[model samples]
Target: MPNIKSAIKRVKKNETLNAQNTKAKSAMRTAVKKADTAALNNDENAKELIKTAIQQVEKAASKGLIHKNAASRKKSQLMKKA
Candidate 1:
């Protein structure tokens, strides 16, 4: 619905960014969930999963997808679960 050329371009850019952010956030959540479940199940690979989850959380935080404090809290929870 953007009649102006710049507005249309902005809309397109925003859509692309939103999609990327959604994907990153989803991946972060999935990684955290997997780590949590593995920890609860006493899986041998739980440590590795936790490591991966922490990395994902950090990545999200660095990208400004989540607050630094929130990332720290998530990392803490994952450690506790592990």
Candidate 2:
């Protein structure tokens, strides 16, 4: 409950950004899970899955949704698994 009008608007904008960031993080996690599963199962498409997952991680980092080091670490681990 912001008393000032500008504060109220800022709060609304923060909520919207939070929701969008949550969605992006969830999608990134799902992509990583899929890539890990594909790798563990020794699927022929594991390479492609890993590539997509890495791309998603990079995009999230670039958008400031996640940390750059975290993104690089995830990509490294996924590539190692592949």
Candidate 3:
């Protein structure tokens, strides 16, 4: 609980931003996992899934949710698996 009005507003903003960040991160991880599984299963749609996963990783990195190097590593790993 924040006593000051500005502090209360800041807390609300922080909460919303945190939720958004969490959602984005979760989506990115899910996309990566889906791609990995598809690749391992030898699915025809694996290429498309890998592409989408790379895009999600790049988006997350651009948004500062993840580091650029980490995003690159994830992309590399996905491609390697595929």
Misplaced by over 4 Å in model 3 are: none
| Candidate 2 local lDDT, 6-74, one digit each (tens) | 999999999999999999999999999999999999999999999999999999999998899999999
lDDT of 1 by residue, 14-78 (tens): 99999999999999999999999999999999999999999999999999999999999999999
Q: Estimate each model's TM-score.
A: 0.98, 0.93, 0.97
Candidates' lDDT values, in order? 0.98, 0.96, 0.98
lDDT of the structure predicted as candidate 2 = 0.96
**What is the per-residue lDDT of model 3 for residues 1-82, given as tens digits with 9 covering 90 to 100?**
9899999999999999999999999999999999999999999999999999999999999999999999999999998998
Candidates ranked, most accurate by TM-score first = 1, 3, 2
Error of 1 at 61 (Å): 0.3
Clashing pairs in 3: none
The runs of at least 3 residues in candidate 2 whose Cα sits more than 4 Å from the true structure, single-residue gaps closed, are none
* Residue pairs in clash, model 2: none
lDDT for position 14 in model 2: 98
When summed lDDT is taken over every stretch of 10 residues in candidate 2, the lowest stretch is 20-29
